[model samples]
Target: MSRRSLLGLGELALLPGGAAAPLNAGPLNGALSDDGDLARIGHRWRALATRPGTAAVRAIAPTATSLWPDLPYPSYTETPARLLAMARTGDPALADPVARGIEHYVRHVYTPGASADGNWWNWRIGIPRRLLEAALLIGPSRADRPLVEAVDHFVHPCHLAAYEGHSTAANRVDLCQVMLLRAVVGADPARAALAASALTPVFPYVSEGDGLYRDGTFIQHSTVPYQGGYGRVLLSGLATLFAVLRGTRWATSDQRVFDLVEKSFAPFMHDGFCMDLVSGRGIGRHPYGDRRRGREVAQAVLLLGESASPAERTRWRGLVRGWGFADLAPEAETVEPAEGHRLMAMSARAVHRRREWVAGLSMASYRIAHYEHGNGENLRGWHTGAGMLYWWARGHREQYSDHFWQSVDPYRLPGTTVSTLRLPDGAGAAWGGECPPARWVGGATDGHFACVGQHLYGLGSTLEAFKSWFFLDDAVLCLGAGIRCADGVPVETIVDNRRTDAALTLGGGWAHLAGHGGYVVDGPLRTLREERGTVRRAYTTLWLDHGTDPDAASYRYLLLPGASPELTRARAADPGWVDVLANTDRGQGVSVASAGLTAVNFWQPGTVGPLTASAPCAVLVRERGDGTATLTVADPRRDLDGLTVTWDRPVAAVVRGHPLLTRARTGRRLTLRWGRLADRGGSSKTVVVRLQSAK
Candidate 1:
């Protein structure tokens, strides 16, 4: 069969409007139903339609002066295509101007510089895809030919070949979309096959420098973990292409892509908000990030749901409903359950969720940075990567909504342990690749519980500390040790720092910062206030002020999100809820008996409770009450080839839900060996072993 014969375009051509019919139906079968979405699309259309020169095509194109020359035409091509789609939906006023705009775009707007710079990849893919949809809606005409020919410039073999090894996943997906659209519109199955073939490489393409890691860390620009920024672009492009290719010969059946969506992308969402840790500098760059809205993830879920089978659609619908987006909620009940705690070891990020609260810990390592100091955004985000933690519950989202970028003290971010040295004005504001030079900067999790540790090094200062966070069911236990700095500045560990109008009270070994939950302080506590613009917000900052300590200093604190004053007082009075099993330069460990979980971060080979390991590792154990315990072990340094774990109790072990072969029982002691740790693809060398008490 010829490549062109596979698409069955002849059948599609005879159906009402030929190649242009699908465009007229609106993108993704009229998925833009939200009032905000419709308004934004309408506004874009109105602006383009009312532009002075859009009503008529130019006789002579303007000379190219600037790289992106303004040619008395709409700079963006997608606007006109979308407007034409809108016009077909009973609004004839948009038709003439849109038709004229498309004419102007093909004649003058698609310039040589734009084509050569490859900046037009986004427009080349998006505009033509939408234009084809518009043509389908408006019916075939002379206008359709020009639009199709213009898109050919993007999807031609020579142009499409350049993006084959593009640095970012987003660019690759955009290229695939262009190829797929050209294949569908041109009725060439060869291009459709090429597009389908392009998508397969991206599914398992784990770039050692950038792209999706097995631990769910998405990196873009080679160095930044951008799950919320460029990662969104990649996911949205895939979702749209999947929707367009559904029921077609080019449709994908790759389970890895679907697994990435459900397992990797889904965990980053909490109540429709992508955690800021993976967002890079997006929060400081745009208002959307500040609002904590995970709109891209929501849109992808909804669009994928539209093309999903009955069972998968139910699961996608349930995930969307839990995000708290009222518009995406389905009328029928959805059976998909909410995700639990996760420690993305490759990303060095931890997400802890309870029934009412969701908290995220953003840490920096030799691999990740505190913040990206580029693109004129996030210039002042110095401490965002120093174990910065953000927790959201009822009424807490609005607390720091407007205060993160320009307001609030950068050194006093919640869950950060830092020196009090003020960052020199405009120190790291310039564009440069700045990553923390630290190792052993990751965590371990058994699905429900996690332990994250970082050997943190201060930027532009000689400060170092061993910081750790233990995420339990109801609370996060934060510990800091091995603190030493010759930088003359006082070192302090900040716990629960946030902007709140709620009154603060400090007494009974506990402090309550209203709108930010409560904290059980293991040391001294203080309140700080900063005024920015018209907002005067107070911050209840709990810290152990180690002033010029030449030796190691340490501190401990328990963060209880959504806790009442009485509960906070009672918890502070009882220390048994959290046990600090170890706090030293070599290791940091904690046990939460209430949750029946114990976590230990062995800075080196060490012992904690009933378990001992032979190398720098992280261990999380959940006592499952039914004569079985779930043990999660990880070598965060990524150096150990093998490690042996010994338990003081008689037990039999299973690895990744399967019984292990390398096990032994001796004198009531159980031992297991995990070998070839660094060879498990790109994932964290972590293994989940379910151990049952041996009779």
Candidate 2:
């Protein structure tokens, strides 16, 4: 075995105990910083300390039924911070109380292994982290020895690299943080070095597991996309570590960690809002909506900028500033536009951004759970990952935040076609345990435009469908085909299940929900208005019923976000605005003439309008308003080594193409060929060609 194999991760070969002196308290405190944002730690210290009934009764009485008197488990951990805050007051009267509280914590409550109940993390990471931070704030104390020893008893040196559990991604970051704090409190340089060195595993991109991916996708719990939950934790932890370890002997210099600011976190956030699609079960938690999560990330970015390079610092600040100011001053000319589209094929998710709005689509595959349910949260998120479409607009800032998840119908989430089979709470699976038997769950995008597709297999239900969303500049063309179910229950395709108080008005075969947007549908549309009040909120729901045991049912619709009712009526009347070329089990395609874009999801060798593929693929052709045209293609199935696409349009020459694009020939028809796609991740490959006038 290699030498690295012997040492294991985050491990070191240390010399005898007399080798070097332990690090002093000053540098560690300086590294942690008592100024800047962290200085706010003591702002409310007096209130927390003086809150008469705040103490944990469980600490005073171990057999107490409630974990704490009035607070929660790990709320006792805040005692150290409260004491430190009180010490900062320099009032002699407070000193005895602070010291006694610290002694009580070290002796009674956190007395090594006493916190073995509940989650392992609370004992090992949560409690120790709070204690050490407060200790640093309070400077040094004679109580440090016992306090640090108590921490070490529960948190072992190699706990980050233990045989199993808590050894990857966010958990690893958390463990490393605890160890670093433990080192500072214990005055041990060896532990600090080991803790910093252990962070290397989290820096590199992982191929098929937890941690960040090359495509800017972050996964936790093996098969769940958790950019909003665990990703925030990873980002926040790294931001603190990067700040705390700067210029120290144990400082991390990995560029990949720095790169994540732009690559992983930035794309999904808009106007200080992170999409619910990547939030996992955290979406079901109270008061933790998209904007709240976005604000947390924005704050973390600002903190991270304190340790980032000057250029990186400026760029991150600009992003945060934009998200902060985007919704403010509506009368001003225009805010910073969220202009682009992102296709995270690795995670089966996509996002499209425009100046007026931002939209996201969530899907599931063999590699990702349909929706995660654990800790008794998100019990009804069975259809969240089955092509749930959500968006944010100018006036609809608090749309989803107005108690939507707790109130909306889980089976009728927007943009999802689901079987109305009744299921129990915590249905489907828990902790991302069950993966939907679907692999064709990705798309092709060219930064500005995208065509996403998903061959969905319903979670814990007998439902299957091929859904596609072609994102245009002003509207999204949504299509679904081959929608079949065998559960003998009604199958419905949700068109717009929105939380809005605006009256729904129908005119000219199009429906518009004031203050939100409008939708143009092809088939019979049903609407329902209801009020849900665990706090009492209103919702507007629209869907198409495919009867019981639907077979090969289909629907096509156009979603115009932030559109006026007049514009909706105009588009509904103008067939030239958007044309549905084909809607069948084998293929689905659309042509948005106004945008000069034609896209298709070919389930097999078939034709959609003038486009034909030799195998299953997603193809998008955009006329760039110039002589040149861009063609993007991908094999979402990831089972093709080669594919040929032919567009029946006269082409002059092949301009440029991807490395895998070996053949781009021009004749009476434009022909493109690609190979070497086996074992690929369904990433998009684009080729540009010079188009001649159509015959």
Candidate 3:
């Protein structure tokens, strides 16, 4: 079949079985358009066309004869494919180069034995998809037989089917794309149905294992939470499939896919900044990994927005504007208040956002690794997932940007409790080293308020601590307990490790690190600066020196992001804003009475305020002040089959928006039981129940 004829077979045609019908090329014709994107495509084509082809390949990849050795060689195919797409839009300037580039790619790059087996997957799927896209755009003739045969040889149906039950989300998405594209170009109805059916396992959501968790965490390469790089690739591929299948026989009716774009994915984005936790070490290794100008979220919004409904388009456009893509929609304003908190149960990470500040707390459970090691970066980041918090507020979006790789002490990440034991240069570099299983590794939140805790085990040392953070409206209350290390090294908890040339101020039980924020320590505080080459960073840290006593030590402080010296002192003196309900090795609790909220991390059954639980759990209780109260409960360790809570008030309760089946009132106490924590599944394993005071 000729390329034009293959693409023209857009009308739905039935197969022998009741399989999905094949779609025409109409959706691929005029549906995707972006002027800036087109201009960039044209520029890439012109750059390749002007260069001496052999000389360009040699200069780009002098080490080997294979085209894949050259990083830009893949783009050599992708650029022409995109240009050919532009040619159909009546751009006559790109016609000649698009044709010439294809011939060059087939002759030099696509030759047999030129591709390395190591990247066989990319050559088989990634390269062929682009070539096929270009051939379909430019009408195929009898002369194009070699190109079609080359693509068919590399991306055969059997090879694509082998990856049907792959563990990684990105791999599955890529394989599906190749299958769908090959089915379209080859005019094979059975392959198209196979591709459509294969998507059933991955589409909408994958809550259990290696795909996208319902909590919005995307696990790739099996264990890495890859919401930035690999996750974006999955999202882009899915968006492309959605666009191509729109109004087709294989169209999806699931709204959860759309919900992923809005709810799960969008929360990780702030302005144009993506938290480095999701980006992994790309922020330090890649040239474009600078956190200041992240385009992952923006690109996804643009591509996905193209296929979204009018309402979703407006919402995505607003997001694009907020990401500083103002040229796309000049009138759209940034989303305001950006206020909410989400604890991704699967990854054991919490994201808290206020109007003036945004904080991400990285924690790890036995189910997830404390930190990733491949790529030569973050080799010493053993403590990143052990209660390491990254804070971004006004004027400090790029605080740790650029200098995080080797400039700062990896052990002194802000909001982390670390023993001063120097890591042996490449310690813990191996992939997939999870922390020891411990209770209180997760947190609880009710949208605006959050309480996260961790029973931390220091990497490569005998150090243990209980770290907790209470994310309130204006300030974050940090608490630590059970900090005991027998290594004789001092234990320190970093309040803020920021990159700035600003001077440090110490007075009135408060220490201001820079204009970004300050710390109100409950005890003696220490301030220091470390110099790397010509760069210097100031840190406001608290110290715990335990010689050999196994006695549990504790510390408390308030992190005031975007606060001035005056405000820091005022908050340090004001005890009314925060109240420590319980602080011990067994359990930790806090109540922000002004917010009418009490949060407890119970290592065992304990009491905080008028609420008590019968087992180890994390609970967040909010008195809504309107005869109603909201309670969020979770078993962070994921061990409890069930737990019960008794509140000293007569009330009727509803769990997850449904009235509980078994609830009783005895005297003035209301009792509720949440059962089958493991059966509920997902990382959260938590339930939100609303209680109304009985009349």
Candidate 4:
């Protein structure tokens, strides 16, 4: 745990012959601490390093090359990893098994013309990567030539300047890793240089398509927000490359990667768990839950700190410490106590982090997919992006893990208003095909607070609604209007579908789930409890039935995260915490008089409370109650030349203005105008104003 030991851990992390840590470990297991806990790392390595039992290794059919012919793709790659682990641990007793494993890989398993049968990834990167690493680890063994040549047959595509269409985002980085290892194993500096050069395209931010955007959105397959799935792979690969290639001719020079630790990834990580909303189809993968993904990210960040600048390294170390030590001790201070709120407009995602809890909102525009189902995963994620909200409170970071994905009804994910129409397995479309054709999917945020909305378009159904979420300090106020669908199925707004065994209590138009939080509803709230799936885990679901084929039906609710049952009842009884100033097709607005905060989603030229917007826009105002206020506005539709707002309150002066604010008038009615926003990609602008006191 000393500074010297921490530095030593980084130095030895990527040395040849070191056992590679498994990327996806079990939930809440394998957290790498800031002090560089070597025993934990060694324990994980030994878990992966422990070779198959004598009988299991002997079960390799004598004539067959594959260790497991019936499961050739992934099972074949495990041999070299075991061999490398044995070699690194210096186990003379297991030397023979390592040699036999290497022989099997070179002679039979990975022999020339080994059927390229399964997923292309297995043949190209998976198999060759392990073998190449084993070669580097064992240090120029006599079997290097045949090993390189055998891997060459399958990995020739990686050596190419371009990996065809497979060279983008995570796939590109994975392939580059293979190329680098192949070069080191083959003793070809030229190949290593090629690998380093091939990585150039992966560093810079992209305007669109499969890459990291400027606004911290990590997209893959050109649509799915994969900050937790493929994005993790990209970061881990980069960290390995940075470590293994350090000081070599093939070393990477792009420093932008260090910046991504905080900008592109940290927001999705809350209390040691990656938010599942952005993980796409990977959420359905067994044993790779949000906590495991978060641990993987933490590991990568720790490794990345070795090459990061001092400021970035300090920040990353604090983050890794926070994630690793979260919930370990309730009394201990965390690295980020008050993360505030963020709206990643490019990814159509928002997160609000409070001291006691964190909430994430996932929405998809035409630019992003609603959900992705491919390779037989996430088949029932039809409503993941329908304004789904995922939150975590203290001591409940494990809520989304432990068979939650398998047992909970996918149709009733919390924070989503979905139709009761039963969807077929793998419903809608795969890849990027599930995106709704709506551009008004982003929001306006002042960093500390935000107003996000989605102009809902049904997926493979006739459902449409306008949904919005106002994130405040105490609660998230949700409003939905213009709900219309004609598919002969009931439309329901799921207040929550919690995975818990605790008692669910309902009283006075409010519901509370023990150990979770509370919901204040504006309609008759329906509740149910059922044991689901093989785990027999219990779930409590709360929703409002909008009935079948209704028009213009609306819903309003307040989600008070971490609120006690008594507090929830009191808030429900008072109903003055927030006022729904308007809820209609043209506009929806809410006001918190105590906070002096008001937000509105203007669907058209309409008036809401004391504010009128002349175009479709999202607006938020924070009044100081001392004759001063700050206004934030955004054109989420991305088709406005200009937007004008007239407020009933008179303005004394424009204290400050944003770059997009073209005009501001101080008169009986304050007027503000903004222009040239069509190309701004739905980013928000803010201006401060001084309001004249009413005599």
Best by TM-score: 4
Candidate 4 regions exceeding 4 Å error are 1-6, 9-65, 68-96, 157-164, 326-334, 625-627
Which residue pairs show backbone clashes in model 2?
A: 533-536
Q: In candidate 1, which residue ranges exceed 4 Å CA deviation?
A: 1-90, 103-109, 113-159, 162-167, 182-193, 205-207, 288-293, 334-339, 399-403, 420-432, 533-540, 548-551, 649-661, 681-695
Q: Global lDDT of each model?
A: 0.64, 0.75, 0.63, 0.76
Sort all candidates by TM-score, best to worst: 4, 2, 1, 3
Among these predicted structures, which one has the highest lDDT? 4
Residue lDDT tens for model 4, 316-373 = 6777777754432233344773468878888888889888888988887898887899
Candidate 4 is scored at a TM of: 0.89
Please give, for residues 246-295, the per-residue lDDT of candidate 2 as tens digits. 54556675778778877888878776577778899989686547877887
Rank candidates by lDDT, best first: 4, 2, 1, 3
RMSD of candidates 1 onward, in order: 7.6, 7.7, 7.5, 6.4
Where does candidate 4 clash, by residue pair? Answer: none
C-alpha TM-score for every candidate: 0.81, 0.87, 0.80, 0.89
**lDDT tens readout by residue for model 3, 545-643:** 444534487888888888888888788788777889887877888878778888888877977767798888788878776656677777777777777
lDDT of 1 at 276: 72
Error (Å) of candidate 4 at residue 246 is: 2.5
Worst 10 residues of 4 by lDDT: 26-35
